[model samples]
Target: MDRPAQISDSKLPPGNPWRAELRATASLAWPLILTNLTMSLIGATDVLMVGWLGAEELAASSLGFNLAMICAIFCMGLVTASAPMMASEIGRMAHSVRDLRRTFRQAMWAAFTVMIPFWIFLWNTEAVLLFMGQVPELAAKAAVYVRAYMWSILFFLFTLVARNFLSTLEKPIWSLIIGVAGVIGNAIFNYILIFGKLGFPALGLMGAGIGSVLTNMLMFGGMVLVLLFHPKFRRYQLFGRFWRPDWHRYAQLWRLGLPIAVTMGLEGGIFAGAVLLMGLIDTASVAAHAIALQIASLTFMVPMGLAQAATVRVGIGFGKRDPVWIQRAGWTSFVLGTGFMSVMALFIWMFPWQLAGLFMEGNTPQNMEVLQLAVSFLAIAALFQIFDGAQVVGAGMLRGLHDTKIPMIIAAFGYWVIGIGVGAGLAFWLDWRGLGIWIGLASGLGIVAVLMLSRWMMRERIGLLPAQSLSKR
Candidate 1:
């Protein structure tokens, strides 16, 4: 079986394998990086727009957003399992075009099945918030936001499926383009609805949620249209006639996706737990934590993007039976991701106060306190980005190798046992405050990164993986 040209020839030029590897990595990574940064900006825009409504509003919105994200992030992780599997299949060309189309239909159906019940549960968001012990007013507002956002779930799931399909097809730029457009639409809609601009009624927080929903729908619609009409996708039978669900492929997808969901859910749960514990301190402290979390999330996008690229590259490489190329793709992506994040970290460190001010206003005593604490946290957060990047990319590489269960366990141990355990003990028991919690997070991510990367390196050395052979399909 012949391997795809992209992976087999991805090696460095005669004298500079490292440089070639870096170039290859950058080729796949840059677009994703840009897309991530843009996505971050969208989040920043949301925060900024909503912050004008006042601190409680901002806090409530952030809390609601995080709650929704907890579920969405886990779902995204589950959907990502498709990327590696699809990439491997595409690289090897193992399945007929018909089979590929049927696989995608089944994947979409599977996603729909999972999301329907999830959305139903979300419809009673206030009750859930109450169970989670949120303030009454905050819970009410959150419920409204959740209900508005719930309408977008089907579209969001579709977008995820489409993005994964495009990514596996090695057309990530399309995903980026659609994301950018969605952000633009979100901003526009938010401006009009949140502030009642352009003759619209001011819906406040609900406006933001509605705007997001509309943007998602628009993006998904556009992607689907492009996929159907675009010559490239058409030539590839990207949306050929749909077929009945194949239980075998459906089960395979579920098996691969479930661990990913658990792994990411645990990670989200740990962070959410940190937020809960932070609330034990004071509203101001929780606000500061939220701000810092947002900042850290921005920095995380770089590595997240790199990890997505690594998943595609490595999955394709593995399918082609080229161990060396797989190793090259993984390492090159790791180095590039690390370096990219390191630069972002330096910027955050140098301009912590300025950056913090972006989320805090008026320089009042409480606001300034949150801002100062956020700056301090951002400093620690800068260092965490390196490990964060490494761990995510390592996981991506492993996903390419179709080795998800072990990585899922590693994430569980690192985040739950080590990260949350240490953070909770320090923050509550020892009274070390917010810093204590962050220290635990950093430690957990660092350990996970080293272990995962080491595992991938060892696997490559043993030749247990090979480049995907396109002819197999």
Candidate 2:
């Protein structure tokens, strides 16, 4: 069942694979960058708003949100399977997988199904914190916050699904627009609820949670509205026959997604564990670590966005079984991601103090102690960005190739075995403390970056590419 070329190969510009892939990927990635950045800004806004509430409130909100995000993000990674899967399917000439309705419906089912367990955990947040040995009072406060924030996951997952769906269809601008709208909505909600404006109660930490809920809801609702009314989207009839179940599609998504979930969890868990280590040292170290980690995360969104775009780009090649296209897309993304992170590393190196100052109180003696520590952490974070960007983009490239299971193993071993082992040994045994943990992070990311890159380079050498004949669509 060979299909003719949908777009003529001659349509490609004359250039080396690097220039061609760079142009293609960047075209897809720029809007995605804005979308991802907008999401991060929403989080930064929550942190900023809660900071005004009080120290205890801020601490509880941060800890509680982190706990929630750990579970939520892992599931989000699962949902991410839709990107590469849909990309490959859409690249197909066959009608069987091209409609996208099945993928959309199945993704929604998967999200809701996963949300059930998360709901139970969020509701029992206090018990979980207690079992984890958190302070009783802190656990109680966090519980209240989690209870309110839990409902937001449904909306959050919805927005993600819509974003991935549209993005794979080459409609990233829609997600970007919705995300921008979300930032505005989030700010307005926080101002009204957190400060008790418009005759609303000043709910403080819980208010922040509510603001988040409203932001996610607005994004999801906006996307849905577009899908319904927009002529382009309406053709898909996404909402038509929405109640039907497709167990096979659901299982396929889960099979592809579960390894991604564990892969993301292992990567995120390493950083969370590093934070726990910081806590053991002192309050100041923990505060400094938080500020530094936030900055790292904000910057990481760049490569993360590019990595997502890479998955789509690579997946298209994989679907067509074009090894050349796959290799080109993979390498171009790697270069661009690492190059960008390199520039960022320099920026952080020069302005570490300035960056940390934005988050700190005025430069008092006590504040200076934290400022210094954060500066040090930022320097280390700067070093990690290069490797981190490479590792993440490598992972995304592999995901596009439908190569998940081995990458998951590589990530786990790199993060837990090499990363944690080295950091724990240095911090606890040799007493380098926080700096040691930072070094550990850098080490893990570097090793994984190398391993993932080698896997990609060796794909043909190892006979990993699909052997079936491929033709254009």
Candidate 3:
């Protein structure tokens, strides 16, 4: 909860900026890294819990959960618009309690406004899934999950807003604590509801969804309680006033947030689309794709966390009109992301079979095939890990600079045009199957990495537009 001092990089003694930047970056990044990883654990545990129910149930749960995530991701992106703006306000002027409060209020209204439609849409997606040509039985089961997860969307998006609020305020540890608590709560609830433990009726997938929904509410409540009670956040006076509609602030949030939403949708959708494409191959392919994707997603959380930190750091620097600190923060994040992914890639390369085996039965022929395909996919996943890390961290840096439009376009083109197109051609047109599809994903990520990095490299040409934007405050 410490108020971040402005322009500390300048006053520091010679040669100290490197260590200073590294320390600052790591301090902000590690808690977020753990938070994202722990958050991801909820999904992992759900998959593990549902695995006992059979492949159909597992696939249904995965499909339903992922579909919900597409909306959730977009909502989170919308909330993300507030974080950098908040951080910049802090760095630009030490006492920005009102600005912070206004952003938080607008964000709260925005969260509710957008998430309701997503929940409703999710509530009625069985027919949509069928229209997509998914298996009838599968679609029906997934719909049960869709209806269940819908209840969680509002709380989940609010939690994202709260997370951005706390983290950018230098109270990230609260969210980390709440996230861990949610995971623990989720596990206990899943055990009780998924298996009829502790006298609860066994509702199966329905139980899982209910458990998740309840956990989301609790997590959001945890954040609010912390903000209300915590000494450091008292100055903001966030909830004291009602958050009436403000079209100007709402427009500001939208213009910045919408492209981020689209960029993220394109990035996340390619992976989801890959899973569906795998579905076209067989149930085994779908299952294997899920397993491999789970592992990759887990590792990807590290860079994502770093990227978030970069956004905050870069935003602050931009607000302070110190492009030097901005560049330092940006490169520092990229290096950390790349270095961490290298280790993850090595680990995946060494243990693909072992990691893939954790998700399925080991003795059966069908499982063996799934394991092999999963291992193959993991290899491709490993190849792209660094690129994924670089691109995401790059995006985070640009976001910190408030450079959203071009990056969004770059991301969409790379993921959809290059990645999915290549994968689809190889999978369907060329008949290269799942492996080809994974390669396509890798190609897309690689292109995105190059484009984003190049953009950051040429940021001098992009100039001080981010800093200029802050003067309007």
Candidate 4:
């Protein structure tokens, strides 16, 4: 007779404790970290390359890109629902290899289905830019960039699905590799196309968009090729016969994904709305807000990577019915996130000018005024990073527990009802301008941090896990 497998308590170390957890977490986190950083670098490169074209081009492209990102952020959140589900399945070891393949295939179809409409909308984006109050010339330029970028959505979505699938399998390194390669490819393409190097036409701002599209396609192709031919993935029938669409599973994914989409959309919408609000103030204020936002974006990658790790760890613990491990994962991630942001905030506080100079050095008088405003805003922004980090990791823990909808609601209220409302009041009524706006943001994020952490704590105290799977019970 075959021997039965043994399962141990989640906290019962197999041999070593700290070393083991560190290894496990690092194994999952490093790739995610690299992926996040590379993704940031791609955005930074776009800004840098387009900045060369002219200030008007840079500003128009930035605004248009931010608008496009609001859409992409929502779509990304919907697709990210796949990560926790896949992680839980892997943790349970319940699915057959073929089943895993089918899951990924369905995810691709879902992503494609969602992206196509958005892509078509973006393809005809000139009207949208005009509607947003762009002048004809700037609107046309923005539309050209958006139109080029729209072509890459399908490919980018495919790569995202693949990356999420790997993350579920505790194989984030593959994502890191592909992300780095994509960044390199993007940089090379940007250099050639943006500057008319190597017989390429100098397309200016349009070239940055084209580079992004080309790199996305390459990344998608690379991921597909790797998954299809790699020996490890080959056993899973990754490229074998396509299964017919399973409506039940599809519905399940959509139900879980929709709230996530709304949550991300709300968050992105707040920032996009801020852009609109800033525009009403002055061009210098808009530029200042943009600089601070970009700086915050760079710092955000650290928490985001930790959050991804938290999702995987919590999913695994929940799958094993190990409440203690689940709690530990959440708290550990929170602590790590806090520590990382603390250090970053210190640096920003110490060298505000140095940091602002990255995007503002040697610019016009208007740009210099914007940089000064951004520097002043950094103090408030820095304080808020702690709360921002905490809330995101808390949300990730909730996602691991498959508790998404409530967090979505919390984010909606926190960002729209509280943050935006307060910021608008402060900016217009209080006449605090940028300072009032950031203060309002801090208040909203602080409330969200407390609420999310409280919810996680309550769930842990009750020894409750999500009801999505059998293992949670």
Judged by TM-score, which candidate is best?
3
Off by over 4 Å in 4: 1-19, 94-96, 134-137, 460-473
Off by over 4 Å in 3: 6-14, 464-473
**Candidate number of the best lDDT:** 3
- lDDT (CA) for every model shown? 0.77, 0.81, 0.85, 0.77
**Model 2 stretches with alpha carbons more than 4 Å out:** 1-11, 14-17, 94-99, 363-366, 469-473
The lDDT, on a scale of 0 to 1, for candidate 1 is: 0.77
Per-residue lDDT value at 124 in model 2? 93
Residue-level lDDT of model 4, residues 206-296, one tens digit each, is: 7888899999999988898878887656667665666578677677778888888888888777877777677666656766777787888
Candidate RMSDs in Å, in order, are 3.3, 2.9, 2.4, 3.4
What is candidate 2's local distance difference test score?
A: 0.81
* TM-score per candidate: 0.92, 0.93, 0.96, 0.91
The digit string of per-residue lDDT tens for model 1 on 350-421 reads 888888888778457867777777887888888887888888888888888888888899999999899998
lDDT by residue for model 3 over 33-112, one digit each (tens)? Answer: 99999888988888888877777788777777777778888788888899888888877986678888888888888888
Predict model 4's lDDT versus the native.
0.77
Count of clashes, each model: 21, 1, 0, 0
Per-residue error for 326 in candidate 3, Å, reads: 0.4
Least accurate stretch of 10 residues (summed lDDT) in model 2?
A: 1-10
lDDT by residue (1-473, candidate 2, tens digit) is: 11112332333577665676676688778888889999988888887777666545655666688788877877887888888888888666424333477888888889999989989988998898778666666678888888988889888987898888776766678899999999999999999988999999988878888888989999999999998998767767777888998888889999999899889988887887776566566556666777788888888888998899888888878877888888888888888889999999989988998888877774467567777888999989999989999999999999999888999999899999989889878888999888888899899999999999999988876766777623331
Q: Looking at model 3, which ten-residue stretch has the lowest summed lDDT? A: 4-13
